[model samples]
Target: MAAKDTKNIKLAKQIYDALSTEFPDSSCSLETDCPQNLAIRGILSAQCTDKRVNITARQLFDRFPDMESIASQEPEVIAEIIKPCGLTASKTKSVMAFAKKMTDEWGGVIPNDVDALMEVPGIGKKIANLIVGEVYGTPAVVVDTHCKRVMKRTGITDSEDPAKVEKDIMKAFPEAQWISIGHLSVDLGRKYCTARAPKCGECPLSSFCKRRI
Candidate 1:
């Protein structure tokens, strides 16, 4: 391996260890009882808080119950129910599209393949990776805003782009750590390495964080 890769690997281990110790019970914040429900929640989570998404999704599912029911509803109705999560028009189309796919194509089974999941309109790489990783236990990294901020600030990757950061993380950490690293990065970002006025001193990774030094 190259010298840069060696350094990143070592640093990544330290970060993983520290974050593991700091947030021992980190998990995906999206609340759902079923895989399809989780997939729908992922679609609704764009530019919205997970807590709001959860609430709106509950309202949505309480009425629809199944993709077949959702697929059958008018886009306007779905839009009305999901308006609280914002982006009503586009999110409505995407949610109905996903439901139709679930009922018409996938036969109620959410796919484990990321690319396949991304075929639905609003389901981008982030949501696709989340669906596969969370739903199927696949080793895919979810580089959300929190993950992006924390990874860059930690000197794990010199890039701010989520895609590049994801690749850097993939190369630095083992496959088993991929899913949890995203959660851990999120914990670090939310608790200490925030986008503005970060709490570096109190951060668990302060000892090794380049930004802290």
Candidate 2:
């Protein structure tokens, strides 16, 4: 292996081990009962906090319990329910359209492949990867804003673009550890490596982080 590759491998191991100890049971923050629900929540989570998404999703699911139910409602109705998540109009359209396809064509089954998932309205690369990683147990690198921020700050990747960040992290870590590190990076971002005013001293990865904050 190249010297830099060997160094990155060692650093990746150290990061994985450190974050494993810090957040042993890290997982996606969104709460859902099934892959379909997870898919909807993932869409709702765009430009929104997971806590808000979870809260809004409860109201959304309460009104429209399933993909069929969601498909039946008008986009306006779903928009009203998810308004708290912001960008209600677009989110509603995406959810309604995606739900319609799920109900009418796919019979409410969410596909595990990235390309297939992207075919659904509002299901972008990050969300697609989440569904594939969490639902299908695939080796996926979920590069959400939090994952992007933390990884960059931690010196795991220097890129600001999420796609490039995902690719870089995939190379740094083993395939088996990709999902775990993705989840851990989010945890690190939320708790310590926050976008502004990060608590660098309290961060477990402080010693290794480039402290881009």
Candidate 3:
């Protein structure tokens, strides 16, 4: 892949500036204080909305409350609690398995390393990066649906693959901004650049966004 063009770089900077003004306090929307909980929440957030994950996690956590509680419980029970988030069976197994591993092996703390996070069940590159970034305060590009859509629409990257998109975005933005850029892109996706009907006219990046229609 060739280096990013000047126009794209300028657009990225504009986006960064605009989003910084739009959401100065932007952070991962998941409501959790512990790194282990954040990692589990990020995994459960896959193919599910953050709002739903927050709700479901709150209820589920109220019942289980800790890694030991979750690790000891049956997957069926976990699935029952998380059914509202969809994909209950698999998500439940994943959550339980992840908790068990963390409790048994890591003493209930999430590892700061990306490769270690990927070792957890149901954690892929995207979720792993999210956990590392949000929990560990490490700089990582989290290319979720919103980030991928906005990046593609703005011509920042040509690929739909999350890994490829992440790499492209990491190359475009400075390392210090990677963790916050994911949340900013998500905010832009929700508020202005929606997947169905993006509000191009009112978007902050309208001056440079290639998807203006």
Best by lDDT: 1
Candidate 2: clashing pairs of residues: none
lDDT of 2 by residue, 86-180 (tens): 98887888898889888888876777679987887788899888888888889999898888888777777889998889888988999998778
Evaluate all candidate structures by whole-model CA lDDT and list the values in order: 0.92, 0.85, 0.85
* lDDT (10s digit) by residue, model 3, range 44-123: 89889999999888898889889999999878898888888887777887898789888899886778888887776678
Q: TM-score: which candidate is best?
A: 1
Deviation in angstroms for 80 in model 2?
Answer: 0.7
Q: Looking at candidate 1, what is the lDDT of residue 28?
A: 92
Q: For residues 134-208, could you state the per-residue lDDT of candidate 1 as single tens digits?
A: 988999999999999888888999998888999999999999999999988878888888889999889888888
TM-score of each: 0.98, 0.95, 0.95
Quote the lDDT for 10 in model 3.
Answer: 70
> By TM-score, is 1 or 2 better?
1
User: Which residue runs of candidate 1 sit more than 4 Å off their true CA positions?
Assistant: none
CA RMSD for every model?
Answer: 0.8, 1.6, 1.6
